[model samples]
Each structure stands twice: as structure tokens, then as C-alpha cells.
Target: MLKRLLLLLCLTGHVFAKEPPDVECLVVHLKYVHCSWNKQGTPEVNYTFYGWFVIIRDSADVSECPSYLSENNINTGCNQPCGSRFNSFYTRLVHENQSSKEKEHELKTKVKLNPPTNLTVHYGSDSNLWLSWTQISSNCVESEVRYRINNRNWAVVSIGKQNYCLNLPSHSSLYELQVRSRIGYACGLSEFWSDWTEPVVWGSNNSTDPNKMNSSMSVWTPVLSVVGAFILIVLVMMLLHNERWVICDSQTSHTCCSFLKDWFKFPEGLKEGLNYNERPCPVREYCHVRQSDSESSDCSTCSVTTDQTDCSVFIPVNESDLPTPCSSSISQF
Candidate 1:
């Protein structure tokens, strides 16, 4: 009898020694369960995966999983019509001896969900939130909510306590909202949880409220516009002020140019006060001719002023229209 018991122990040890298939399982939004084994690296017919099936046990369901590995060897599973979220489900694979080798996997540990999408926040009259978002993964799962006020530390709210996170405290102060998810108590392992979603803010408080910004920016907008216009004007003036001055060529200066200049020059009036006439060069064209003996002239020069009685004129000639030549013919005085 002792030998028989020893033989049973040996058989049990051998069964345990045989390596299990590498089984991984996930659900498609509760549409179906998919379990794959030893996807590609193994040398078995199905990439070292022998015909096998997944086994799952959790708080919600406890049984050898009905899901089958696909013939393609990559994927297989049973229909899970409930489309449920799973939490803390233990999973492993079973295959024929000498077919494949693998270890156990938790649904939560195996499947990593993307962050929730399209998070939005709206405050209701009762201070409740009209918050909503679509889960990133098609598979159904449970989620938790977190919130903060004015850049403070984050605070958590139980998803079970609040339906779809609707029981937030109503406040006028700004509030930041965020969410993270994990496999639920459904058919999957719930050991893993996704990273937090991007945050959303909502509020009507004027002071320190992100949504209610100060009006100082609006006031400064016109001032900035004026300054910009002034700068533009100054730039345009500077560009136009750079004038190219061409020297008036000296070669072109002539009588005509001088005449134009003189014509345009302001006239200073002629010399005033006591006027005395004097010819600049009085002796224009003449040589002194001696008076003829019979003429009895006092001087050789022809006289112009007739009223110099003391030195009476021998012959008067208009100085304005003077004679061309003195006549040499003799005449009696």
C-alpha cells in the first residue's frame, strides 16, 4: 500500500512537471472571449501550441473556461454575450503533453486599457455634474473618478458610490475632473489598471478661476494695437526719409541758369539819398584836336555845359548824342 501511494505521488509530480501552454485571454466589449497560446516563437504545429483551452476563475464566475484556442493558432474563445467587465480573474492554459509550454495569466495583468476618451464636465442646477466619457477599450470595464480644486492635490471618489460619477459636490469654485479604469468583476482578471485620463475643468468663480479669466487682457488689446500702428507709421517715415540728393552739376551752370537764378532772387532797391551822376569811363573815343587859328577856341575839348558863363562854351554839343568826329574845316568864331 505504501508503494502504491508513492507511485501516485510520482504520477502527480510528472503531470505537474509537464509545461502548460502560454495562454492569453481578452474580451471584445463583452462580444466574445479570445484566448491565444504560444503565438509564434514555439516550434509546435500551432507555433508550439497544442490544441488547448483557457481556464478562468473569479468572484463573478468560477469554472474551467469554455474558450478554445483558434486553429490559426493565434486566437480562439467562446461567446460571452454578457459583455461584462472582469475583476481579479485567474487564468491559465492546458494543452496535450509535448505540445507547448507557458504560465498562468491574470486578465487585469494581461490587458492594458487606453485612457478614457472625450471627457467633458457640465455643472447642473443642483450642483450635480453632467459628466460623460466613452471608454477607450471596447471591452466593458469598471472606472474610478478623481477631482481637484485650483491646482491642488487630486482626490478620489468611489465609482460604486457614485453612478457614472454624478455625485460630485456642487460648488462655484473651479473643479478639475479625471478618471482611470480597470477590469471589472466580470470574466477577466482585474489586477491591472489604466493610467489616468486627461483632466477637465468647469466653474464660474471669477477669482482664480481658469474659465473666468481677467478683463485686463481685453483692455490692453486696444493699447497694443495703437502702439503697433505708431510703430508702423514711424517705420514708414524712416523709409521715406532716406532721400538721395544729387549735386546740381557745375557744368550745366550757364547764362540761362544765372538768368533764372537772378530772376527768382529778391530785389534789393537801388542806391538812395543825394544822387550825383558820374560816368565810369568818361573818355570813350576821342583825341584832343587843336582849335583852328581863325576859330579862336579857348580849349581843344568840345564843351557840353552851356551855362558855365565864366568859361563860356565855344561850341556846345549834346553829350547824350555826341558827334562822331570833330570837323577839321576852319570857321570864324
Candidate 2:
């Protein structure tokens, strides 16, 4: 029974030692082929790789891996140039007294390209946006552009060229753009896509937006115009009313009419009249009469005078003392 257990253990060890590494090969940007493998359960064992192209009649022309990717001096991967011909590639991993099964690959479809470069954006005089970039791969590829407005959801567009135009773009919106590329159907088929480029930003709220300014002004312009017109109308009416009361007289120092003076009368606490008492003195008439203290007769001598000089006089007399025949003399004065 002990001998049987020893034999079984030896067989198990042999099987474990014969396990092969997992290998994979792919092409990059149509320039070279990269082959990599994962080490199987043997941490102490070292691996070496061999690869070659298959020709007509299944003839084998093998060669060692030109450049090796290693870890701890153990080969894990290799890189080689891909010539201008399409063929089946054969690869295998080998370690002393143990070799992995040969693996075959058709690399026409396993392609991946690098991201695009130098993305730029510009605003034209016609209020349009232009986005462009530089392509690093020489192969014919179709580009996809992804963009967002004002940090919103992303929108994608596919084009055959490297440049795109947006007509009549909004002045108040922000734009962000990125690009990715893949092999075109016209050149060949590829299952992989390149990585997206770095994001390019244009426009922002910090900068002045002409469209936003104009929109705000449009709401208040009409209200300001109406207020200005109302003020102008009030001023014109006041000027017309004041023009009717204005008068010029050569005889007096004041130029206002009598009706205007009444309109400008002061209140009870201020001065009373409009300077009527300050007028120049006019022509005067004088009347003279004499009477004795004795109670003898009711008649008296009366005299009247009209002056062209600066003498003036006034006298009061009772009507009963005036003789009826002398009334004509009093009437003349």
C-alpha cells in the first residue's frame, strides 16, 4: 500500500510540472505584434519564447523572440515587427524538459491604436465653432467626436475627416469636446477601439456672454423709454402755462400782469400786497372855505384852485352852510 501511494504521488507531480502557460498575441497600430503569456503554477521555473510566420505547404521557419519582456529574469512576453504581409502567426513557451503546446493566431482583426493628439477649438466671426485634432496613426480610420454643452449630457458624432463645424452656436453656452478613432471598413476590420483623447474646453460663465446681456436688456428697454417720454411731456406743459402770464411794461419795473400778481399772492404769514403803495404821486386839486365864530349868518366864502405846481390842500365843509345859489361854484371845483 505504501508503494502504491508513492507511485500516485510521482504521477501527480509529473502532470503538474507539464502544465503550459497561457499565451496571447495582438497587433498595435499596424506597426508591430506583441505576444504575452502568464506563468502557470511554477514560481521557480524560467520561460523562453519562440515565434515565426507560416508559409505555403505548412513549412516552418522558426526564430527566437527578438525582444523579450521579463520578470525576475524569466521571459513573459515578446515584441516583433509586423511586415507588409498577412499570415498566420505561431508561438510557444519552453522551459528545460517542458514545452507548451503551439498556439496559432490570425492578427488581422486584433488591432488597437493610440489616442488622438493636439485637440483645439476656435470661434469664427460668423458665430460658428470649429474643432480639429491631429491623428498619429498612418492607417485609414474613422473618428468619433463626443461633445457636451454647459456640462450636460454627452452627444457623439462620427465623421471621416479630422475637423468638424458647428453653425450658429449659442454665445452663452460652454462646449467640451473629445475624440476617439477606429480602423475604417475600407482599410480593414478591427474589433478594438482607441482610447478617447483629453478633454478640450471652450466658453464659460466667467467670461462675458453677449447673448445673455442683450436678452436682459431687451426686457427693460421699453420701460425706460416710456418713463423718459412721460417726464418730457410734463416739462413741456409747465413751460406753455408759464408763457401765457409773462408781460413786459415800460412804465413799471415789474414785467408781470395784474392777473399774474393775484396768482402769486402770498399766504397770511408773509407780505400782503405786490408793491402797489410804491407808485409815483399824481396831479392834485385844492378847495378853500372860511367861516366866523359868531352865530350871525349861515353863509361862508369858498375858494377853489387847480395846481400845476407842487402845492396841495383838502378841506371838509357841511352841505347846509353852502348857499343854494352858490352850488354852481362848488360844482366847478
Candidate 3:
């Protein structure tokens, strides 16, 4: 009887001395099972995880984890192919000569999905800001969006669709947005929500109204163009005037006056009762020729001159030479 009593005490002591590590299991993306454990009171000792998934209402043979996740060359987690959703997970931790007690976990509510990716923001013509992202499982997940204006407090809203729109957004304020997702009820219930995605930003903090700036630009563009054309025309006119001044400075004063008068004077030849000569009245002509090949031993010859003609003569005119007009009455006195 004393031996039996000692055996009973030994068994009770062994059971009380053993402490199992805390284990956790999760279904990732509804495709695989991941189980991990932490050393509860055995920090110095490393633990290796092993798990088996069995249907809740069915019996199945045991299978080992396909891949083991390790830390510091010690097995710390187990990865197994996911079975039915209505299943229970059995996990154990082992360390060489010692092993932990088996633990059970229900996996129906333990699903966790990856975070949404490629978050995008767009401002539409209807004064609305649209936010959207690419989801891993498009129809099987729901999302929640949180946004803040100009680094202020965040506003969160739940959405079933992949996109959300904010109507009549403020143009002067900046908008910062993020989204997170979880499994929907139609697919399966998940107790965990995905981590929030990287933030997307739109709009600005400037206080100036964009519409007013655009209107001002439209108004000033045409005015600036007209002003530029007028300046160009004035510059061309000034250049032409300077060129005329240069031409006048290179000639005699009489020629310069004639040059200026020609621009404004009408043709005298087109007048009615003028008896002026068609050709110049007192033109002088002089002609001379010399032998180009004359030598020093040969006698030099004088050039022949033409005699002066009547057309070449100059006559002075006085007031007495002018013709007198007929009198209305032949000296009535």
C-alpha cells in the first residue's frame, strides 16, 4: 500500500510539474494552416511545432507538416495544407527528449487575409474623390476606408464594394487615405482584419481657389498676347524710321529735301496748263578720247570737241519776260 501511495504521488507531481507552451493557429488565405508557439516558461529551451488538421465530423489519418518555419535553427512554426473549414487543429511542441501536451484549436473563425495592394486615388470632374485598390479576393472580402483632410482627424467608413467616393471634396485641403479588408460572411467569417494598406494622398493644402486661378489665367492670356503684338508693331515702326534717318544723313541737303518731298508730291506732268520743258533746259555735255596704247616716243594727240548747240544754252528770265493777261475793258477812260 505504501508503494501504491508513492506511485500516485509521483504521477501527480509529474503532471503538475509539466507546463506547455502557448500555441496559436491560423488559416492564411483559406489555403494553408500556420501554427506557432511561444516558450511559456522554458525560454532557454527551443521548441519545434507539429500539427494535424482533422474534419470536425470526420476521422482522418495523421500527416506531417509539409514545411517547418524555423528561427535560429530551431523549429518554431508548422505550415500544413488547409483541410475543410469545419475542422479542428491539433498541435504539439517538442524539444529532443521532452514533449508538450497536445492542444486543440477551432479554425473556422481563424482566417486572416493579406492586405490590399496598389491603392489609388482619383479626383473626378463631378467634384468627387474616388478611392480604389486591387484586392486579393475580389468578391470574398469587404473593406473599410479611413481618410483625413490636411492631417486632421480620420474619418472611417465601411464599404462592400472595392471603391468609395467622397462627393464635393474640398480643393484647398489635402486628403490622405488608407484601406483594410477582411473575409466576408458569404465566404467565411474571419476574426482578424488585414493590416491597413500604405497611404494614398490627393489634393493640396494651398488656400488659393483653383477655379479662380484658372479663370484668371484664361482672362490674362489673350490680354498678354494683344499687348505683345502691339509692342512688336511699334518696334517695327521705330526700326523703319531709324533706317530713313540713316538714308537722309548720307546725301546733300537739296537731295535730302527732294527725297522727302517725293514721298508727298504729285506728278507735275499730269497737270492741265503747264508749258514747262519735258527735258532739262540747260544740259552741258563734254566728250573726250585718248589712245590707250600711246608710247613715250610717239607724239601725243589732242582730243576733238563738239561745238555747243542752242539746246545747251542757258537764258535768264525776268519779270518783264512774263506774258500779260487780257484786260476786261480797253481803257474806258
Candidate 4:
């Protein structure tokens, strides 16, 4: 019986010797979010419960002691309670990593402004343009908004908050505007950039017509003036002729009789009652008169009362006479 007991004790020792050492913590997977670790030990073993493990080395002088090897060590969990706090804790880690890598990274991130909504462009005075947008999200800690001209180098316009009023150099050039979310890394490696907006082309207030500056003042102005003057003359003459005559004497005076008698009467030496000499009047060469009543003689003057009246006389004048009419008239009874 004593031999069997000794053998049982030896077997127990062998089993314990084969058992693997318990790890205080283990690093499993890594991502932007939570990292996992396992604490392995017997339940009775004393455990400080360090949260995570990171590979670290000591750099102290140790000539008197054996050279210490660099080893993975477990770090204490964040002072705060666990839970969603892991997100905040992870973020802090990321920030630290970024600060360290900054020496090697070429690009830097700056949050000029938060994400803007309802972005719009407007033309300002002095032929300059302005861009305005609304702020919606402010997820970034330090943020900046960048602008590019024709998709060249990105130029940072403003930082923190959404409203940016950029004074464009010229209203004639086109522009492309976009927004991005900058985390604690290089600019290019940050979260995906927002989709590019439609191009906004600038416009000019100047007239589009090329001839507007070089057009002659007299060409159109004088033509319009002559047309207006002719209209006025015709209107005034019609108004005057429309006046009714009060005939108190032996002869009733018509509209044409007064105009003709005052201007074109024969000289006093002519016989009082002889038939008028019907010479080919020189005025006839230039002016042709048509009487309203077809039976009336073409030489007799006809009266027109309404503004709509057709002229009874047509004159063939040279282009030089366009500004004036009736430079000459023949005397007649």
C-alpha cells in the first residue's frame, strides 16, 4: 500500500510539471476599436489584473546585473470604468501613435471647419465671389476645410466651424469645392474625403455685345430721332388741320385755302378773273400730289384731317435732304 501511494504522488508531480505557465494577459486582435487580451492563471493565483499588454523595453544601466531582455509587459487598465470607455481609451492610443509617427509622416491634418450643409456660392460686389455653407457635424477635435482651384493643390481656407466666406480673386474663373473629415493622422490617410461638388463657374457683369462700346451715336440715335420727329410733325399737322373753320365772310375758308392763300398767291399785276396759267410748275418735278377724290385735279391742294391720313404729295429728294423737307416751294394762286 505504501508503494502504491508513492507512485500516485510521483504521477501527480509529473502532471503538475507538464502544466504550461499561466499568462497574465494576451494580445489577440487589433483594429481602430477594441483590442482583446486574456488573463490565464489558476483561480487561487494572485492577479493584479493589468488590462492590456504592449511590447516595451527598459533602457537603464545594468552592468552589475545580468543583461535584461526586452519583453512584452502588461499595462494597467484605464483608470476609468470599462465599457464604452474603451472607445475613448482607444482614441487616446491612436493619438499617441500619431504623435510618434508624425516624425516620419509628411502630411498633417487640420480641421479648418466642421462638415457644412447647404453650401452655396454668391457673387459679391467688386466683381468678386463668396462661398457660404452651414455647419452640421463637428466630429473632429481639430478640423479644417480645404479648397482647390481646378483640382490642383489643396489650399486650406478656414478652420473650426462651417461658415467660410472666401473672397475669390476673379469672378471669371471656375472653382471646385469639397469637404473632408480629418482624424489624428496624415491628411491623405484620414477618413474618405467627401464627394466633389459640381463646378461653379464665375460670371461677369459686363455687357456681352461686342459692338456696344464702338457703335456710333448718330447712326441709331439720329435715325430714331428723325423717325420720332416725322411722327410728331405729322401728328401736329393733323391736329391743326382738324380745327373747324367759322366762315363769317362771303367765302368759306377751308383748311388748305388758308395755307395756300397765305403762302402761294399770284402777284397783283395778273388779271383779276383770268383763267390761271397752268405752266409745268418746277415743284411738280420733285413733288407729285394725289387728290383724295379721284375726280379732283391732281394740281389742287387736298386737306387731310386725321393722323392716319396718307400724304397727298411724294417728293424724290437726295439722301442729303433726309433731315429736312420742302427746301423750296413754287408760288401759285
Best prediction by lDDT:
3
In model 4, how large is the Cα lDDT of residue 133? 55
Q: What does candidate 1's lDDT look like per residue over 1-333, in tens digits?
A: 999999999889977664544555664433444555545444244322222223344223434445444555543433333233333333444444343333443343355566678777776776577667777443457788888776678788756322354556546566788887766666355565678888887874454554445576677889999888667655643553465222222334344344433543312331111122222222222224443432554334543322221222244565654444433322221
Evaluate all candidate structures by whole-model CA lDDT and list the values in order.
Answer: 0.51, 0.69, 0.69, 0.37
* lDDT score, candidate 3, position 167: 85
Tens digit of per-residue lDDT, candidate 3, span 167-188? 8888778889999998888777
> Higher lDDT: candidate 1 or 2?
2
Model 2: per-residue Cα lDDT over 231-331, one tens digit each: 76556446646874453333352434344445544333322333333323334333322355334433334233332223243345577564232211212
Report the C-alpha displacement of residue 278, candidate 2, in angstroms. 41
RMSD of each: 22.5, 16.5, 20.9, 22.3
Query: Per-residue lDDT for 232 in model 1?
Result: 69
Of candidates 4 and 2, the better by lDDT: 2
Candidate 4 least-lDDT 10 residues? 99-108
| Pairs of colliding residues, candidate 3 | none
What residue runs in model 1 are displaced by over 4 Å at the alpha carbon? 1-112, 135-141, 161-172, 186-189, 204-333
Clash count list over all predictions: 11, 0, 0, 8
Enumerate residue pairs that collide in model 4: 111-143, 111-144, 112-143, 112-144, 112-145, 112-159, 112-160, 113-144
Pairs with steric clashes in candidate 2: none
* Superposed model 4: Cα runs more than 4 Å off: 1-116, 125-128, 137-142, 150-152, 183-333
Candidate 3's TM-score reads: 0.55
TM-score of each: 0.32, 0.55, 0.55, 0.24
